[model samples]
Target: MARKKIVFVIVEGPSDQDALELLLNKIFDRDRVFVHVTYGDITSRAGNTPANILKKVQAEVGKYAKNNHFEKSHFKEVIHIIDTDGTYVSEDRVIEDETVGKTIYSPDSITARDKQSIVERNLSKRKNVDKLQATPLIWGKIPYSVYYMSCNLDHVLYNKQNSSDEEKENDSFEFARKYKSDTDGFKRFISESDFSVGGDYQSSWEYIKEGKHSLERHTNLGLCFPDSER
Candidate 1:
């Protein structure tokens, strides 16, 4: 039998991977599914530039391939998922709150102890996301796409945007468990949810950029798994 090619999924954090890893594997049964957790938001991290974003992705994919001794050709496609994190919101929507230690993302505003940090982070993240969206290939070969979960995976999946770390893990674990044996149900949950964005890929990206919509419950993840059933 021929070895199964890979469908590499790039995600922002462990929680994101924890939530969707099993479901994705079930959905892409014919292909090996690998979820590469970025640990942090790569786009908003310091020293990451729009110019080198794809290279960063290349490095991640390369690490996986190298350890497995699998060539790049072993992959079928790359699907990158990122949290919008209110990145497209206006500056005024980033409100400074003395009591808020970590940034709190609401539907219309981002409340942070350090508002400027959020503002600057949003600007840089938006630029890098645009760069990613504009690029159709990773490392000049693999087919690639970037999808959004705004203001983040927590918000879109659980309707809880400001969850603590413990809550996040519990929520993700439960969500994964709920749909682990019901991948089709998971597909319907994502595609038919109120937060699901309509239209083609490009238009979905465009939709997330308007006003404070990026801070709301919205996702284009359905675009990744058309005809998902086996």
Candidate 2:
């Protein structure tokens, strides 16, 4: 029998790996893809950054080709999934209100300048990876993509859209947690959700870039699986 094509993916955490695993199962044959989670915290090590992930991917591809005595084309795709958390602004940034004699800051808040800086920094990182001939699927913030599927896992699984913003913010983790015990349930929820309604890869990429799917949902999962059955 012919060997199945391999598509490699690197993600930040186990939850991300699980979610992408489920998604890839839908897009390709179950045994065709491999998802690796770095569990690297971006604050210190640039966890799952495009360049870092691609380095590992290159090593893996090299090893695989050497073992199989085949060319790199034996692999179908090599992709990275990164989260845009503190990349937008330093988490240490804070403002002092002299009038009130207090410090005011929210983890979720980003100034216009900070936003621009973050975007530029991320783009530069991506360009560095592209120079290495690998592209990544970046998720703006942590839960934005999960939010695109529904307000939260409760909303996606139970049709309950009443989750608070805080709950919604952590929905990706919650969904990943649930996926561990109930993989089928999560798969079922995904099958019935409208997460892929924005046409094909390029269209969805444009939608996310234009901030239609939430300014935070700036991911390229669509591009990673351009021909995926949606």
Candidate 3:
């Protein structure tokens, strides 16, 4: 049997694509899942715009579909992931469980908050919500693969009080802090939560990783991976 080809387009940088590739290669099994990932201007402030991202995605998808001998019908089934850091205020907050979600900045790093607490603080609650369940957003013909974290590379993950190199390797928090502190670093995150087009890359990648093909109003989602029985 021939493997299915899925095209993934990210806004910019390699992180979004790297994360998806990790998940695909490790969790989804690469043998049956053929993937082509493209990195556009996901990291840049200008390229993160919804219109620009969508335009690039459409062009790439169209090109691949034609090259792969896929017609409009098959192209309709192709999934697109346009990652964002969720820098927008609207997308950053979602009222779930009577709590408003927001991003908070620490001395060394920034992390997302569900109401007053960090997302990690409510890991138990995260289990209740299906991790894979996607929400179709009003970005374009594509739904996003959203991972709106509070911290970018600029934010320190480990020690907010101290930003020494010794503290970084011990914990992820410190590492985040170092990245954020760097000059023109990718520490500041954006996504559907926030309005910055620059932060939309990760969510976009997540969209394609889950095999979501956005067409017109109605979306083609819940397409299960070959190994995972949905």
Per-prediction TM-score: 0.96, 0.47, 0.34
Model 1: CA > 4 A from native:
226-230
**lDDT of candidate 2 over 1-230, digit per residue (tens):** 87876666656565455445765655666347767665553322444455464445455546655776756555665555554332333333322233532222233333333444445544554344333322332221111111122212233333334445455446655555666666455444454345533455445444533322322323334434434442
Full-model lDDT for every candidate:
0.90, 0.43, 0.32
| Top candidate (lDDT) | 1
Tell me the number of clashing residue pairs for each predicted model.
0, 0, 59
- Clash tally for model 3: 59
Task: Summarize candidate 3's per-residue lDDT along 1-230 as a digit string, tens digits.
Answer: 55543424332334433323433333333332334546432323233333354444456556766787765433212333322222222322423344324544432233443444433323222221123124342133433232322223222122132233443334444333444334223213211123222313334334322311110011111122233222
Per-residue error at 107 for model 2, in Å? 11
Best by TM-score: 1
Candidate 2: segments with Cα more than 4 A from true spot: 22-27, 41-73, 86-108, 111-197, 211-214, 217-230
Cα deviation at 84, candidate 2, in Å, is 3.8
Which residue pairs of candidate 2 clash?
A: none
Candidate 1 local lDDT, 79-120, one digit each (tens): 999999999999999999899778877898999999888888
**Rank order by TM-score, top first?**
1, 2, 3
